[model samples]
Target: MPAESQRLYERIAQKLANDISRGQYKIGQRLPSERELAQTFSVSRPTVREAIIALELDRLVEVRVGSGVYVTNTEPPGGKAGATDIGPFELLEARRSIEGEACALAATRIDDAQLAELNALLTEMRTENEKDVMLSEDADRRFHETIAAATQNSGMIAAVKMLWDARTRSPQSRSLSAKVRATGVKPRIDEHTAILKALRQRDPEGARAAMREHLTRVIDALLKATEVQELERARQQIAEQRKRYAASQ
Candidate 1:
């Protein structure tokens, strides 16, 4: 694929793969910390994280959580690299742009029944979230799709569904989501409530802003969940050094 056409994470993955193949990162060696890689590539840490996941999928590296990523194989298995999957951050950005408009349109056309359904779903989301149930995500998906259906625009519905499908089906996105969820991040019920309140008020701009803000927070959560805490690692190392000094004394 052309460099311009590829996702930022994909481009980073290709460069890192090349570096590995060229012996710059030897087998079993730990790659640079995520912060260092982000700095070197001039990309965000989440983008670097997606690249690392891509490398893992290709069997070129393995992620050792709370430690670092390590090179496993210089060459991809069967001489074939993994398919370029959509990055999680890229997917969320697309949703923020497209779904914001979808929410605005829905605000004008949504009926009382649709609003009621959204309210019920909101309750469901809260219940499932309190139990830490994965079903909360199902309710979350339906909440957005119901808004699209309210738009009464088939194209809008399809577009929204396509984005949700990508989130469900893309390997890279799924991997990142799994990591994020493992950190106890759940859907934001308050944001969803804000969206529904705007829709009920028939305020298109309010609905748009609320939807955009919700997705923006989701993106922020993903960034934080995937962050490799270099400072924490530094503290651990310091503690180890202090123990060694005490033992010697």
Candidate 2:
């Protein structure tokens, strides 16, 4: 297999490791089924299996035939963090690099029909947002997948999928996303519209710029979300101390 393809599976394994450490899958707990994980990460069953194997090697999880994978009651191998563990900002940076290029390519190759499909998906997302409904990331995934398909490059499509998988599977990424959502940060409909407009005009550079800017906004949001979480935690701590002091009084 090519180096790039091999690296994709490694990213999957690291994502699992991150999830395990962050307590998404606790010790001795059954991890999500392979099919479920594949669907969640937008990867294939074989790729998911490879990641499970990596986890087993690290003693982070154990796979039992006729049952399923289970988290091990032990730390990751050598008590070291998973090699694939990455910060949320790092994940966004990877997306910015790969998806930006994919967006640029899509600009030149995307057909009118594909463009229409993307617009419909974005409209669906906007409607969901307007209703204050919890917007599903499925539509968001499809929008990016459509762009990758328009690029007409199998490798590019796979790379984009791998990056997205890392985001959904990584504990750090998921925790940051939860914070952002709790803070009521929804998808930026207008930002996506700008990206679509760039593609509609077949402006590669513009498409690239729009995609990069979108991911940059995500990075900024993640940073702000982390700060908000920390501030809230500090407030809780202070409140607890105040209660204790009043009790002494």
lDDT (CA) for every model shown? Answer: 0.92, 0.77
Candidate 1: the clashing residue pairs are: none
> Considering summed lDDT, which 10 consecutive residues are worst modelled in model 1?
226-235
Looking at model 2, residue 43 earns an lDDT score of: 85
Candidate 1, residues 135-226, lDDT tens digits: the string is 89999999999999999999999999999999999988878878878999999989999999999999999999999999999999988787
Q: How well does model 1 score by local distance difference test?
A: 0.92
Name model 2 segments beyond 4 Å from true.
1-84, 131-134, 228-249
- How far is 73's C-alpha from truth in model 1 (Å)? 1.8
lDDT tens digits by residue: candidate 2, 116-223: 999999988888776653454668888899999999999999998888888778765665566567777878888899999999999999999999999899777655
RMSD of each: 2.5, 11.6
TM-score for each prediction? Answer: 0.89, 0.59
